[model samples]
Target: MAGSTPNDQPTTTPEIPDHVLRVHRRLVEAGHRSLLAGGAVRDHLLGLPPKDFDLATSAIPEVVDALFEKTVLVGAQFGVVRIIEPEGEVEVATFRADIGIADGRRPETVRFTDEKEDALRRDFTINGMFWDIDAEQVVDHVGGRKDLQLKIIRAIGEPRERFQEDRLRMMRAIRFSTILQFPIEPETWDAVVAEAKFIDDVSGERIRDELERIIMSPHRLAGYHLLSDSGLMQCILPEIEQMRDVMQPPQFHPEGDVFVHTGLVLSHLSEPSFTLAMGALLHDVGKPGTFEDAEDRIRFHGHDELGATISEQICDRLRLSRQQTERIVYLVRRHLVFMNLPQMRIARRYRVFEEDGFEELLELCRVDCLGSHADMSLYETCLGMWNEWKERAPSRDPLIQGRDLIQMGMTPGPEIGSMLEALEDARRESEVVDRDAAIAWVQARLDGRQ
Candidate 1:
């Protein structure tokens, strides 16, 4: 999930791959003016390699289908078709103008139109340019080239109308600003702020995906600040807004407030995976719910566990994949284990090293500390111990297995799992020295329970 740095400066546009150029030529040769459209044109001008290329043409979907050997009419209503080749595929869509509906993204009506009309209907000026295939120049009907040159994110036409046609455009605006590291135009920013609440009209999956892009970017912390400033954070993640101004005991957290501390944690991360980023953001999420001022210090009695539950609910709301949610929750729940780890028994420490997500957990621990007290003693210790056992112990054959337990007269059930955990813990401590000893120890425990 860590992000890579993009190109330093805009360069000459990338040469069109032969297969892609073929589609453009075919459309043009047939007298249907085709030009490279949307992000590809924008990225080319920016010197970033566009992931995929799309074409906008005067031809309709049916004409495109008839022209190409391998074609799929992905959206006949919108006049879009995919041209497949041995190398890859290109999406060729008819030039069209659209009207945004109030409730959802589907345009009220789509009319096949010309290049100028299509460019005017787009979301952002930077993305509204088209590459003139024959003329070797950019066709900027909506001042896209100027906006891109100035490094500003500006809506194509009326800002409100552009966002209202599709609410997801609001999130996309934030995403582009954050990723491109460009400031939003004043009017566009206001429109996003005024219509931030409509983000909910977009589906959870769509929101999740766009949010993922923002969270995954290196400038994500800035993205969050923008989200908060623009009021989008409240509609999308009110839980984060809850952390605003929550006080921490100054002795431990010299950082100003909960939100500031979380931002610091986010800043400390470099190329963080999605799980790490989420864990950092939600690490102290439960502080508000569990905060208590006792005689001695401010306490969050069970904030770690509580934060885990709350994070799960948040993840479910965002429609995160089950695996991503589980790992994130694990990091939040066990983040405090490091403070107690120094006092823990050797076996317990080793067990921590052996946990499934130990590496990510350790990272969470390091950042959590860096964000707060700036302590590294515990992290250094854990890293040392883990390094010592790095070659052995963690992967050492379990002194026993389920089948071995069954052979010793233990049935296949939940208790077998329990026994294995206990046996492994004892084995790590050398309390059970070998396979025979492990079997004997478990047999005795089973006998005692019986």
Candidate 2:
């Protein structure tokens, strides 16, 4: 869906929320000038209601800090102060120009300047525009408002210079394009592809965060295609790139290639958590290696196993927490198991529920199937049975303890422990209906052996 566009006629204007307008007016009344800035302006021009709002001002950090009851010097050197109101928090930054960036992440130095320089220094044209609340006018220092109407993502200044200032912006361009459903202008896209390798200099945490946004965005498939097209995926996650053109059997997949199948799966995801999205994206990572040409058709033997291993390595490289890495690997490894859901016995279904990381495994399989052939009979059957078993079989303490077995003329050895476990399994499986039956079943087995 396209975002809402701002009113075009000079006399026609949409009503700004009273609270936000009052906040803007209050800043001006306190002898400080403020402009509704950054994303709010971008969202407004796109006719979208912004989720969060920020402000830019000509007031210096110390000056603005004294007026607000709650203020934080979020970027003091750059004249940025965070104002906390009961309703919300707003960032007010003094107009400034960056000196140069020694580190790719932060400005080496910042000097307070006019709005023009500040707008120019920003990453993208659409994000550079400002709304001057006091004057009730929109500021288009970089023609951002125009660019927004064009449905294009263009760098504020020279694409190369802007990328050099902060490498992560290259990824942001793709993200904004995906979020806005806008096309990245040719020059901007080329710049991102050319400098794609510099994305390595960015911290893993930052890159991971951007990746999560791209994968979780509504247009995740388009985002992935952009990443692949821009060559960023090759630099950041070559493992995903490896899936391209790897064929799957037409009998099952009919989806042509592994990459296309994966992309379809990503498109099917809805508000997927970080782990689920990443798991879906990497679920078939092993397909390339496992693909083999057979007499009748192609096959990917044990791709799930190898994909799990690859998922582990990728997570480790990204420095994810051990728990997260393990969960993702588990999900990838078991994604294909849903195919066996219908044939599983009730006891085995409950056992699947009890397995470590079972819930995540189920979700991965769900999206995987939904993305592919869209035939979900197996998933529906398995999930239904699994839920039914769980609901009916609330766990109860076992009837036959090892001590009980030992007291019944069984030795205190592996046999006793084994018998107790067997009884417990039988109870869970409904093979032994009651506590007495469980004990009798164990006794019968022991008696038979004797």
* Best-matching candidate per lDDT: 1
Go through the candidates in order and give each one's C-alpha lDDT.
Answer: 0.86, 0.82
TM-score, prediction 2: 0.85
Per residue, candidate 1 scores C-alpha lDDT tens digits across 104-141 of: 68786788999999999899998998888777777889
lDDT of 2 by residue, 1-450 (tens): 144334541232335566567666767898766777788777765676766667777777787888777878988997888877777677778888999897888899898888888899999998998877656667888978678778899998799999999999999998999887999988998899899989998988888889888898989999999999998899889999998888788777877789999999889888888888898899999999998998988988899999999999999888888988988998888887777767776556666687888877777777778777778887787788778777886676667677777778987788777677677667777788877887789778977952
Evaluate model 2: give its lDDT: 0.82
Error of 1 at 150 (Å): 1.5
Tell me the lDDT of model 2 at 193.
89
Off by over 4 Å in 1: 1-11, 100-102, 409-418, 431-450
Q: Compare the candidates by TM-score and give the number of the best one.
A: 1
